[model samples]
Target: MIKNLVHHKDNIVTISETMNCLDAIEILEQHSLRNAPVVDATNTLYRGNIYRYHIYKYKFHHPDADLAQVKVTQFLKNTTRVVHENDSFYQLIFAIRDLPFIAVLDKENVFTGVIQHDVMINYLAQAWVADKSGYVLAIQTRGEKGELNKLARLVNRKADIQSAVTFEKTTYDTSTYLMVTLPEYLDVSSVRALVNDLTRRKYDVNVVTL
Candidate 1:
């Protein structure tokens, strides 16, 4: 999964402690970044993050103020930021949607970097495309292994299917389930044939779309 590739990469923008509000705004415009992390001299920990909207609004309201005199810290967003590394693409999508950009924090809450919404979305889309395999939810069975293999083989014979798998075991009975994805759509008769074949073999099969 793309979650494994998520890490504190150096691609993230950073602002120095000495940077003024104008400097931070200029940097944000230059890099096309909405938010950036503020770091001290050693660049060990992040003090806060500055959003472009804050700077723009301040400039609009206080047009006559000296830009150099305004401190970047004064305009920083003081709220706690959500961050995650190695989180699944599914989780990352919701996180990015909920938060502006998740600050990639280390064990000590030290800022490592940030994951932008666009970047994370692209990663998730790619992962979805890669995981083209089909999934099935089945009831547990006594001889599930052999039955699943045979069912998979039957499906593959009619279509260009790949990577069949099962999910979400229910404990009501010994029934097994499998999920398969085909390169193309299967006709209703083909699906019915599969159900009939499983029934004849004394295996209770339920096919579901995922």
Candidate 2:
């Protein structure tokens, strides 16, 4: 998961606070981005996020205003929407849901870059491993030790595993659920056998998607 979120240095985009609003707007349009991270004059310190719509509105309200002389530093917002480079993957998801992206900072709080919304969504889609050619099983279990190992051992002997993801079904509950994808080679008879085996072991198994 960290590999999906972090190590994205090649895809990050940013702007400098010293840049004029017109220049920033042009860059945003060129890249087709909604928002961008603003950095200090030296481009090392993170300032805040600048939105394309805000710049467009400013231009509309002040048509004769000198856009070249107007710095982006004066109109930046959500300066606190930032996460450290070492932050957990969950933190990145929580921070960027309501925004376009979150600024990434180093140990010294220096501006690095941003994890864009589209990039995160793409990573999550890959993680889910969506497919029409496979069976996805949702198994509900208590937070028990060795349960995963037992399930893996049982399932591996029967069918090829494609992808798996475990998540807490609810924040207030201690119950957890595991979603496993079986290869497309698995047929109805094999799926029924797998389900029966899990039921025999006193585990709740259900077919979620196929």
Best-matching candidate per TM-score: 2
Off by over 4 Å in 2: 1-13, 56-70, 125-133, 143-145, 171-175, 200-204, 208-210
Query: What lDDT does candidate 1 reach at residue 121?
Result: 65
Q: Candidate 1, clashing residue pairs?
A: 135-179, 136-178, 136-179, 138-177, 139-175, 139-176, 140-174, 140-175, 141-174, 141-175
lDDT of 2 by residue, 170-197 (tens): 7786568787888777788898899899
Per-model RMSD to reference: 7.2, 3.8
Candidate 2 is scored at a TM of: 0.73
Residue 83 in model 1: shift from native, Å? 2.0
TM-score of each: 0.58, 0.73
